[model samples]
Target: MMNHMKGPKGYETEGPRLIFEKKLTKTNIRPDQSRLLMPFKSLIRNDFLRPGIGAILVDQRNVKVGLMLTRWDMKKNSGGGTLNYALTCGSNDIVKGNRLKKDDDISFWSFRCHNVICFALVLPP
Candidate 1:
């Protein structure tokens, strides 16, 4: 049998695409870190995001949280580099408010609403 997670409310008609999913680690849930590092090359669409852009994401409880899209470059020995993305600003509060802990699973979804970039977080049951 195939199991499918329910789509977010109000998005049944045209649900947002799944951007990425992560299992919270020590650094992710820790208050000191205060940032959620997305996987390298995880961003498939650039039209919706830019470096230093502030994004508002709605959590599972429908609470809108503000976060920043930051780009980090890693220098390589071969004169090349890699780009990485992370969510900052309100990461700590999301961890605290949602009582998220290490090993918790979370899925992030993205969609454009009226020319505005929006995201949604789906927490494990």
Candidate 2:
């Protein structure tokens, strides 16, 4: 029996059993498991990011920078999820997220909660 440990995202057990999965690559990660083809980088809890919340990535001092959605790890305290910097579009290259802060304009949407709202930001042209 393989040992299981608390991991980011979900359960961090052995990459499932061979009987359960076929064609193993990269340790135990299967091609069918996730849609993320690129390598993922681990993220940690910060002043703005609460683990497991959908986050919008933007550059410092700019609001119009390309926005991408990312999530935190399932295990709040220990585990953190992944993101690919290559994906952040044209605003400015985020070297290290020098200025990541929570947008108070938005609030935390917890797990199993499907509350969503719409707002508009009209910038002067």
Candidate 3:
């Protein structure tokens, strides 16, 4: 996790730690798929997430997008204890609203506002 990093869209340079950043892939923007996969290697910390709980994230425009933090356990099927995570639920709306295309760079930042966990999706200039 990166702390005290500059935020996108001229946000404060004091808070909003960066969790991960990646270029959009076809799977992320496909309407049929809808979910944005967070590869294991890219995840900084997931301790802030609660199981089965959905979260609302804001974009640079302050548009709210609901997303569910989900984990896929490989142990149940493949007998491997590895786990994978993804952001689901309203991810498609985020993609549509942001006009995200393949290879478009985006970043996820985490912060706490009024004791509530908040996230922001940032687009590269």
Candidate 1 least-lDDT 10 residues: 1-10
Against the true structure, candidate 1 reaches a TM-score of 0.74
**lDDT measured at residue 4 in model 1 versus the true structure, 0 to 100:** 16
- Model 1 Cα lDDT, one tens digit per residue, 1-125: 00112334453323367778878889888778888877567654455567787777777667778899898786799999887788899998888887888899887887654445667778867
Per-residue lDDT tens digits for candidate 2, residues 27-71, read 222223221112233222122322223323222333323333334
* Model 1 spans with C-alpha error above 4 angstroms: 1-15, 42-47, 74-82
Give candidate 1's whole-model lDDT.
Answer: 0.73
* lDDT (Cα atoms) of all candidates against the true structure: 0.73, 0.24, 0.73
Q: Name the regions of candidate 3 deviating beyond 4 angstroms.
A: 1-15, 74-82
